[model samples]
Target chain A: MRHTKIFVGVGLLLLLAATAWGSDTDGVTQETSFWIGGHLIDTSDYYKKVGEYRSFEEDVWPEFGLTYKSTTPNSRFFFKGHYFDRDEMFGMISTKVSDIFTGKFRYNSFQRQTGQDLLENIEAREWLPSVPKGGGKILTHDITDPDADYNYNRKEILSEFSALLSRENNLRLTVAHRAIIKEGTEQLISNSHCFSCHLESKSAKVEDRTHDFQAGLDTKAGNLDVGYKFGYRHYESTTPTPMAYYEDAKHPVKGTSGAEFGSRLNYDGSSMPIDAKPKIEKTSHKARIKGAAGKGQFASSFALSKATNKLTDLSAKSWAGVFNYAVPISPKTRLVAKASATSITADDPYIDVNTFREGKPSAVDFDYIRYSVLDRTTADFTAQIFHRLNPKTTLSFLAGYNRVAREDYPVAGDGTTSSTIIGQAKVRYRQGMKLTTSFKYRFEKTSDPFVSGKGLFEVPGDALEPVHYGYDAATGDSLWGYFYYMREDLWYQAITTEPTDYHEVNLSSTFRPSAKTTLNLKVKGVIDKNGDLDSLDVKHSKLNGNLSFTFMPDLKWVLSGGVSYRMEKSRGPVAVALFDG
Target chain B: MFPFPAVRGDSTIGEIEHFGSLYTMADYETKAQNVYLSISGSPTAKLRLSSTLMYNKSTGEYDQVNMPDPSIEVSSTLVDQDFTFDDMHEYSNLDYSMIQVSLGLSYKLADGVTFTADGEYADLTDDAGYVYGIESGSLFMVRSGMKFDF
Candidate 1:
């Protein structure tokens, strides 16, 4: 509620200031302008109704917006704000102080409402038991009595500042900070021994705060351009604690309860721990250098950085470096190269937490792990050449190579490395200045295939052995739900390795048939193969086109239409594992 | 895996296990198509009108990757015949779509003055998802304002 007021107050202040900043400048001899607007709005209801996933929730009762700018010989200021019916708001304020410094502050908040649809679905699940342990069948379902609301809200604020450090105002230092707060609910499910298993959801409150500070210096010293910068960023996040439970209570084994069957009804109400959500924080430091080389005809840059993260008693570190440069071979030709490498090392231990059942902690479950010792290093390189074939045509060629090596404490055996190489070519041509066409072709291949055999590596922890179930008299004609279990000491029972190849083609074109008519088209396709075997072969293709016509040449009146077609064909069926038989 | 303590002297040891292969290579296919048209015109420098028309349709057979099969993922309400596998066919005819329309207008108050009014109307339609026959919220909007400079 406090944050809500702050956001609304800031938004309203910005709007009023932008609309009310008139020409009465108290003899400051400055130029000023202001614009204000208001709107009448209504939604399908007091809340927004979304058609599908990833759709926007449009809502509001009324809205207003305004913008204002004040300028003088030494300084300038500007403000803008917009508030919608849903109470969603946005604000931006910027100012320039003489030739010394410049700064800007921004605030934005978006809202989504889903309680109506969510409740509808929850109430419709009559097949599931209405209340836990109430009976063998569902009779009634309700979560409101337990205090839960399905309203999501997101708000973010960012501020940045930069100061001029030289008389020429070419050297500057900058810093910025941003805070993002998000609240939402997520539905969770489990693939139990049965098809339909756990149906639950958790509502969490999460917030992330990040701060960036950078200082750089740039100057021109006789035919040479040099610049250096150092930046540091620290980020932290507080995530929601998971609260898993049945959306609507259900019979343990879907009716059929007797001594012949499982004797007792052992229901698991919730398993989420009090501190289920880890408090995560990461900080990184980076430095960069850029300069003009080869008599100012080539540009070059280098960078290096490191990062660290801590969660409880575990932590991780990473190091990275980059080098880039570009040079012109001729008036119409240029070559650019870039290279980078990164290495991350982490050492963590396992953890044991108690599992909750029937609204209380029943016993300890050593079936969890925090993290394992992991170290990986990767390097990549790319080279590109651009050439002008003619006054209206251009061509480019690019080649890239990448490799990775890793070791996992849990499965650190043989074949812990992978590598790939790629090559691509592109062409662009303009015909009669009315149509422009571009095409790109790329090929990729993996080398030195990595193979991991199926086996268990001896490690330190708790585990169960591979289990076998069979039916016997007095045991009923049935199979035990437990198929196999890993010994706490070993993981990765089976592994496989292989090489792969990938090829893709892309084409796009734009045409302006007349001053008021335009057309665009694009086609793309990709083929993926696994070595020489038919290991999950895949084919993908897409086609898109757009045509637009403006009745008036001034663009005051316009119309547009677009369509896209996409298809993915996989020869090997990945089979259904979630729901279907 | 169940880790409960058991007294081996039980009368009967009835077991519970899942049936049918988890995944299979089947003839699965999905198809979708969409078409839309839009037009806008300004009769005068101060008045404008625009509207949009859209239609979308999707169908699937033996395939429901996007059909909101919340069954296997959430509850068992969508299935009619328990685990008889007959319930799987409930999703065979996974087809749904809608025709949406939006109309908007804007008008200026006077010449040389930066003042305008804006409004829009949207027609809410029903859905075929689990929330069957439930119509989305309709929307109406209008706004007016002016600008000044000195």
Candidate 2:
């Protein structure tokens, strides 16, 4: 309630300013803690994933905590607070003055619970029989509001500042700000098809907000060390925009053609407006540099960004460049390298589904103009090497390459490109602190990967040949070539689960056999394939494992334990489409 | 491909020609398991104790590999029919299991006061129920507190 009275009035004004600054400061230190709690929850079946992120509701709460420290001699202060209810809370503050300036502030609040997809398994049944009169009808749903309950409430705030401009070639200045808020109520589903395979669900209202700001500057200009940053972000969603009424096209049991069902609908006797939430803005710029080359150290960066979409005014722009290097090559070898490049451009919109069957004699004119699969470009490179060979061993090796290019997609005017190559190896061992171990292996290869331009069993077989599109003179009926070419020749091209070859493996171990026992273990594996999917050999696999332990047998007992396992499997190809339209 | 005449007079063949569908292979799976335990202690100098335990289990499924003969005569007057999805894979199966437990205690009366208590329990077992049905649940929580320091 009102954020629990502003967190109990800021925890009683920070406990009366830390008790009057610890009675006239002098290496001050303070602590304030107060708690009076009550919590009780008993659930039988509220199953929202077991109170999705808690608040199982059973109240009566009061908790407050504070800590402060200051050790004069050059000034420095820190503070912390925790007020546990009102959807959890936290606060922090920091300060330093004397060695030039520093500041910090933070706040957080949380709550999340969402689950209400009672779609009832989306039923469907159409017993063939040359479908066309509602053929065996089934599939129906309508839940205008079935005791909906979704939740959301998140808040965050952060602030930071830094200063110290100039002190013999070591200048600095930094600033930051952040804010986020979300309020909720959700659940919206709308469906309509061929006329009556209905389904409808409602209730939607959510407010969202986000803000971010950044500023930076750093110095040192002789051996390098340079920096620059500027960023801004904004997002909005003031709720209110949820409407649905559609459902009026015709023939669902002979309601009559209605312009042949409004010529493959793109809007129908409607109320429109459903699920709308857009308004975003972003801007960024970055530049960085770091020094010392020959013996090691090197860094570089460049970035630019722009994103906008205030209700579809549409915009997107991106740029990136990066490089890094580390060196040493004697007395135990070492080397590292990295490179990156990125580009993106977007802005292409024009759709007018308003002319399809406008005054039909079988009218046709489906306006179009859209192509932007987020126009992309990317490049990456990597190199790594490390060696120790003795003193508790160490070894490493890596190689990488990547490329992607897209301007349209799949085959929109023929635009596509992809490439990938990677290899890796690692090993580590230690016996000093009882034990330590590591092992890794990786490999990847790809070329022409990303697919999905009308996926799923690229249909053909002459799209099931059977031509003859001529009758229907007020019910002579026969008009068939499989409904005008079986959806443009039954999708015959792109499809992918994205992986042309892949392999990975990892192993880890850690053990501390003495001073208060400890142990850990890990394992991972993956396998992927897509051999150009013709008869669909697309495959996927994964496995994971973990084990943990810890024990402290003295100082009054302490123990721990853990175990984990995971498995995943996939195999593609599932095409079943033969619509009787 | 001949066999026409329709408009409700029925001589069959209005659509669906030969094999225009059915091409199975589908198989999707998921599995998960987890276990955890923790314990903390302090035997003297004002009491303290803690405990925790957790368990989880998961499953997901979908299957199909071969299925096609349901009637097929594609010729003399065509007859094709072939469709079966096992109730859409048992309405998209998923099995679940979960368990959690927690406990804590503290004591140190005077000098800056302290005395606290905590408890929690959770359980779930939704064995294959999709689309928010039969969610099986259990939960219990308790808390008591008294702490002061200045």
Give a tens-digit lDDT track for model 2, residues A1-581: 34334533553454344334434456655556666666666777765676677765665555556666654655566777777677767887776666676667677877887877788778766555556454544568788889988888787877676778889987888877677777878888877654666878888888787777788999989999999999988888877788888788776655677667667788777888877888899999999999998789989999999989888889899999999898988889888999999999888788877564456343456676787887888999989899999999999999999998887885555778889999999999999989999999998999988888774543423424544545678988656433432445556646788998999999999999888989999999999888887767788999999998999999898999999999999888766654333
Candidate 1 local distance difference test against the native: 0.52
Which residue pairs collide in model 2, if any?
none
TM-score of 2: 0.32
lDDT of 1 by residue, A403-509 (tens): 87766633553325678898999999998868999999998887643443434232222223322233446956533322113323343322222436778888888
- The lDDT of each candidate is 0.52, 0.75
Q: TM-score of the candidate numbered 1?
A: 0.69
